[model samples]
Target: MPGYELINNSEKKAVNEIFDNKELFYNGKRVKKFEKEFARYIGSKYAVAVSSGTAAIKIALKCLGIKAGDEVITQSFTFIATLEAIVDVGATPIVINVDDSLNMDVKELEKHITKKTKAIIPVHMLGVAAEMSKINKIAKKFKIPVVDDNCEALGAKWGKDKLGIQSDICTWSFDNGKTITTGEGGMITTNNKDLSMLFREYRDHGHQNNPKFPRGRDTHRIYGFNFRTTEINAAIGIEQLKKLNFIVRENKKRYNIYKKELLKIKHLKLRRIPKANIPLCDCIIFSIDDLNKIKKILIELSKKNIITKNVPDAIEWHFAKYWDHIFKEQKISKQQLETKFLKSSYYLERSIAIPIFVKEELKQTTKKARELSQIIKSFV
Candidate 1:
């Protein structure tokens, strides 16, 4: 029943400056400036700008040398982009289940590790960090790298470490719905110089170094792709980064309001994340014993202009066709695939991400949530 708006005048002005200055290329000054600003915010030695979050993941995998026959362990309940990135790098995705927090189940990871396993991608689903300590220990034991998919978790922290600060390589998205928007952009953060170089080169068509010269210059170096983010996007990103703290504070405030209001409805359940974690999005997941009745109620709410959505499905559904090909190619038994792929440890059937943003006040959203709660209770 509430409303949401995109970036305000301050963000618009930054975008205008990029066009006014006529700097549109990735190698332009605006892009460099934003990269520095983002790296400082994320506390990483290097940040490579790319076109999108999916591109960031693909480049990170490439920089890490994840290739054909490599098994990359990841959760099966994440965005398809996460799995697709692994597959793009010619690596076979080793799907695992998620825990109660909708993060990679550490126990399931060890069972699936093979000699071909090269890395583990621990996604900070809904902004909550996976059990990174346990996952990192396992990765260290197996000599596998960790690439954190932090697209949905811009300012999330676990213990004392920031989400992207502790991994071998971390990726972030600046999509329209994320905590910050660069219109369409992404960033890859890492401390490894060699890996950073690889990502930079890959983003700029395999140029051995910076290519800011005239026509027909020596630009091509190693094998790469065109995944570069423009200065215009980076300029918008710089402005967004400036308001990061404000955005995070408002999101947390809204989450608390939702928690307070939803608690009054006894039959409704909310998804649980660890107390130590800070989420990127406020997801309310519930399970109704009578699915048809709940669907009827939802439809009625929709007629009243109230929106809702199902939480993400298990990864198998999102990547079913891919898994089929993988299973047949590897000649793995159907039973093995089921055990490895079909079982999702944490599956919530009814869930929705209520609106939250920096410009909105918590009191208003809380009141709305309480109103919705009352309607749901009437049905019970």
Candidate 2:
């Protein structure tokens, strides 16, 4: 879920747009406009709409010609969708450690590359940008393509440039929890014209226009899956895109409140923000040494009807060890990044995420934020 429910004029505008033009329910004008506007917003040559972020990644990988036995490198800490997309397309995920910024460590890229490494999928985790400059620099050296996973950090920037254009192809999500939601939808952005055409065809069951038939009559050019979303979602996306900057600014405002109050607390270690990147967050992440202490605090918070969630278990779905299903099917030649891995596990297990927006349950004010911080310090 999003940190809080958002009520805005843009949502009303979305409904109006959809209601005004409801005839073209599937693959219609709204979807087309949203794609164009989105492309322009991200400064990409093309944007292909898909059913979900997972579909966006899958299509990008497919267009890149990644197949079975191809190893794709990505962060060890990210949403499960990133890993599942690679596996769904018969590719292995070469999990790498996240640096101090809790993103894919660029320094470790060279050692992970081998003949089977087809692509690098660096995830922008929790609205934070992974070091794209160094990651792209290394990809350039090896002549490998990168599938930028900008699902969590859509409007977030890496230096002066937007996050989408740094890689060969990139994806953004519009599901419920993302920075901006389209109910259930995703977009694929790329500067490659030929690849964009393939993406267009791929999303619609490989249906390409045929001169052999008339308009609205097309034939399958290649085998493709139907991951097309509806016009209503696209319409919502169009409106949401307009307010992205405001939403990002509001989120940053709330994040700063948490930072100001939490900095005085002794036991918590906040995540490091990358130097050149502007990340938007709905929650503030902090790492602690004792999971048991956090559990006690979480329980106490729940008693007061304030929820503080435990960090995602890196050793669970996000970690490399928990992915036995993917690894079991892999070739024996796939080697480990390290024989012993605990640092990633340590951070994830002891980490905690405090929601910045708690809806009407907790008024979105600095005073309430300070209260939340005190409650945390009191528990520790």
Candidate 3:
């Protein structure tokens, strides 16, 4: 249920207005406006727009001064971008296994923490929140900062509050395949004024934006790189943000249809969700012990022109077990990677993640869910 499905003239007008203003990158008008609205929406004191989610994570790491020899812990069930960002920052990624929720297992989290562990990133994969309360408590005990990788769970909630705001720092993605889209962009949200100012400066090549002078005479607080996003993307993001509630509501309706039907199959176990969490509902995942049945259901869904989100369809990119080719220096062999994440593998290998669409009618969604359940029933 991405925001792209509900694209309308409002987005077009926003983009046109950007061009009509004749100030694309200099003024930071649309970017500022989008950042303000997004901060208000997420209940954060500040929001910084960046080139991508990876950049957001890297910036967070940079702001915290995480470097070589420092250890950053994340779950094995996340997109490789999280690992890549940690590696790019010269920090070693200590990947832990996920629980039934397909998120960072808090029980296993502290076992791997060492004196070098500087940051812990609990990724909310596929529109569900991680056990933030537990994760935060552990981080507090160790005095390690928590960075919630909320790229996939933008509109999700843990308890009554938004998922991202619970942690020390949260990073978000507005890429095309998310709850909302800015074609390709990201954001970093935090309540710390100093951290927010540092993020803003770092993303723009350390431009302090001194009021006394122009861009050419801008002052710098530190050496930085360019990770700035355009006003065009921010303009579209504003429009897309307006439709987020509608998308989430529609997604829940469709998700519940699948949930109700899938529950009829006694053998199929829905992915474990925390009682306090209300997921984004854009994707539904369920695990079946029989690998053969899982494969057959995927084949059947394909025949019906239905596509899965990420569990079995795009697992190579999402799961870290297949990323040994890139982590040679970290001594992560493919076999070792597989063995280390066996717990995560059990759920991921036997799961099917079906995507929910906002544009589809509820009746059609119900029919599809029934058909999907029937397909699973046949396999069972």
How do the predictions measure up, each by TM-score?
A: 0.86, 0.88, 0.98
How does residue 330 of candidate 2 score in lDDT?
58
Q: Which pairs clash (backbone N, Cα, C closer than 3 Å) in model 1?
A: 76-315, 127-280
User: Which of candidates 1 and 3 is the stronger one according to lDDT?
Assistant: 3
- As a whole number from 0 to 100, the lDDT of residue 259 in candidate 2 is 84
Per-prediction tally of clashes: 2, 0, 0
TM-score of 2: 0.88
lDDT of 1 by residue, 160-267 (tens): 656788878999888875778886889999999888888988988787664587534646657899998887788778877887777666677777777777777777
True lDDT of residue 380, candidate 3: 91
How does candidate 3 score on lDDT?
A: 0.91
lDDT of 3 by residue, 16-89 (tens): 98778876665688899999999999999999999999899999999999999999999999989999999999
Residue lDDT tens for model 2, 315-364: 36455645555666654222442332355666666666666552423345
Question: Which ranking of candidates, highest TM-score first?
Answer: 3, 2, 1
By summed lDDT, which 10 consecutive residues of candidate 2 come out lowest? Answer: 332-341
Greater-TM-score candidate between 1 and 2: 2
Residue 182, model 1: Cα distance from true site in angstroms: 1.2
